[model samples]
Target: MSEADYSRVSPFWQIEFFYCNSYLQSHSLYAKISASESPMSEMVEVVIDSIRVHLMAPQRVVVLKQSSTERYLTIWVGPYEAEAITVALQEVEMIRPLTHDLIKNIFNSFGARITRVEIVKLQDDIFYGNIVADAGGREIHIDSRPSDAIAIAVRAHVPIMVHRSVMDAAGMEPDREVPETNAPLARQEPPPPPSSDDANRLSVFKDFLDKLDIDSPDKDKPDSP
Candidate 1:
């Protein structure tokens, strides 16, 4: 489909909108949205539904719920990282600037604005991310840890996205059958679950999900804009 076609029927609510510069072509990127239309991209927009921790070791998990569905993508992160994301999510005023706070201030100091943050890839159990920033007129993609990217995103109120392939691999829905919506008129291959290896590898993330501290994203989140 062409850009005009995508403009007519995108399902996203509030997603990333990137402007093209010389660096954009090198990256082969598409605009995730516009004031007028939601543009399609390889990534799916998600929200930081909640930060959860369990009694188990390495317990901190950051949950990303697909914007329009119950499907979730969870990433286990370090303690400091979890706290940074939590502080940002809760809009807490810290006594002193934390590391992420410093990063945000630096962005302001340098005149670079964060356009979006993405959990770009998942490989062997490690998740990779990018913080996309607009440096003057050029778009810069910075390599970042997923936790750091999310921490920064929440601070900037930027869209956090996961690649479709990563979602297919790690995303889980509460129910087995999803009543599909926003379907294209033509037939297409359904996305497959990423080799069951991920289920085994990332299974720790699902344990606290059913526990009391963790709440369903549907209830916690407001209706998307």
Candidate 2:
């Protein structure tokens, strides 16, 4: 779609579409969002960076990057939940259903579907999440840990959101190098890692624009020649 066409969509959906393409890479999520009334909750959309298993400690971390923002949130999770998120992100299917997969199946059989997951709070370094679903003609919100909530959200192809207050307080710009973990993010997926061609092309194009004498958005005057 053209930029002009995309601009016509509501900002919520603009982010939703971006999330679909960037993270899920599936149209199912887009379809689900479009079918529901826009949610009234004020939340910031975020995408999972990857599941990081701490090599130095017996713990796991799930990193989340706020959509269209520089802020990142890191939550410590258990190994089981870390594996669940890994399998969902990598699209790994087991011969027998894992616990998370079973939960999803139970919801499906009940005609309930997860609409979104929200990281609603952070206190004493612990983050909490809520799973929003529709079942029996009413909305249902279940309290959860950020890890388990994220795992189910990815499996359901639903949007994950973080409350603005929580993000503002706890989010940080990630370091130049992400820490090495027992679970390597790159190896989770089967496809060859993304080539740097697109990044290089975009970098070159940005440099070209930088060379032009363009005025800032706040400044109407042209640059001094």
Candidate 3:
């Protein structure tokens, strides 16, 4: 598509990454894809897709495709990683201990706590993530899969942040606001009345002009023989 056409489309953000096999990729690629689409809408759709993909078994991989930048960020994850994220997105709780639950319990036992998750770098088509934690009164960083890190970070109430460069390269401008679809009808106010004081003043002025007789030619003319 032309650049102008692309710009006219709404901007969007690719928030989730997924993994897919060759067959799945080929089948999925046939779906409608547009650059500069609505980011908020896309995020909602991604969450819904994750739930659907994980219904039978946890997804091991997912790809985040950004049409604007034409970039595909592929993230490799384990089954547990997929299940935790997908379940969280679906707002459903599993009966047994999920992987993230076990990790959180281990951290609690060790008196270590997760502080944040950082998407620090992207190398060789692999996005690297780090988990920042407080252990022994010192901050420690552990290398982790972006998906796993995010899943744990969400459960631990830790912040998730991406590098500035990544955001700049992948982020799209937000779409413009749309007009109200169903605004209530407004009542019309009555018009204001003219001032009585101004009318009186005008009448007084006219009386003064009449007293002057400025245009009376008979009074100003010489006496006739």
Candidate 4:
């Protein structure tokens, strides 16, 4: 090739180099942003232990038990939210779907999945949480009440988390030793024997009806007594 042809080749190489540099810069920026979004200090994983309610009052609380520690976190919630959390923990179906159920359905319809829930803050006796969801390539962080976040997390079978700072501030240990027998067991009931009154009620009723029948030709009319 001639010297002019060599100049043409140089421009092509320059363009290729520029494209590669631009791509690397864009990738590095994305990495930095992702790292910033998710810090190195990981949150502690937790599970919903129970929902408690005070008698004859609207006040309710949801208890979260740390999976990796012996600490617990309690967050007070409203009656409706408490019910939602209880329903999810019991794996019970409601006659009408509750708010959390509706949200789960909406997420499914949009092909989105809740990946995690984080109890990120507790300030002035109030708690805050976030729902991390994945919709295909996009991940979203939604601000939510701790109760609602937990309720949805149970239904989604997602990991529930507490910020290390939050745990350090509010985590509590059980006041009493937990009994090993307190663990859940399969419920069993004694079998009702065939001789039980309830088991013979139907046959007893049939016998009484046969004795009272008066239309049979061979019936003894009680000796006219």
Per residue, candidate 4 scores C-alpha lDDT tens digits across 1-225 of 466764777777868867888999776531222221333266888887656553335566676789987787767788777777767776786788788889889888989888988788767657777878887978777777788888899899999888887887667665577467754566545556667543443353233323433355343111210
- The TM-score values for the models, in the order shown, are 0.65, 0.59, 0.44, 0.59
Which candidate would rank higher by TM-score, 3 or 4? Answer: 4
Candidate 2: residue 15 Cα off by (Å)? 54
Ranking by lDDT: 1, 2, 4, 3
Clash pairs, model 3 backbone: 10-36, 12-39, 18-62, 18-63, 19-61, 19-62, 19-63
Per-residue lDDT of candidate 1, residues 1-225 (tens digit): 468865775455213333334457556443332121112378899998776665445557788899988889988889888878877776778889889989988988989899988777778779988888788897767778889989999898899988888898788787578577787847768678767766676575465556524345444422221
**Each model's C-alpha lDDT?**
0.74, 0.71, 0.53, 0.69
For candidate 4, give the lDDT: 0.69
**Per-residue error at 59 for model 2, in Å?**
1.6
Q: Local error of candidate 1 at 22, Å?
A: 27
Residue runs of model 1 more than 4 Å from their true location after superposition: 1-40, 176-225
lDDT of 2 by residue, 63-124 (tens): 78899877777677787787788777778668898888887898899898889888887666
Best by lDDT: 1
TM-score of 1: 0.65
Worst 10 residues of 2 by lDDT: 216-225
Prediction-by-prediction clash tally: 0, 0, 7, 0
Alpha carbon lDDT of residue 210, candidate 4?
Answer: 36
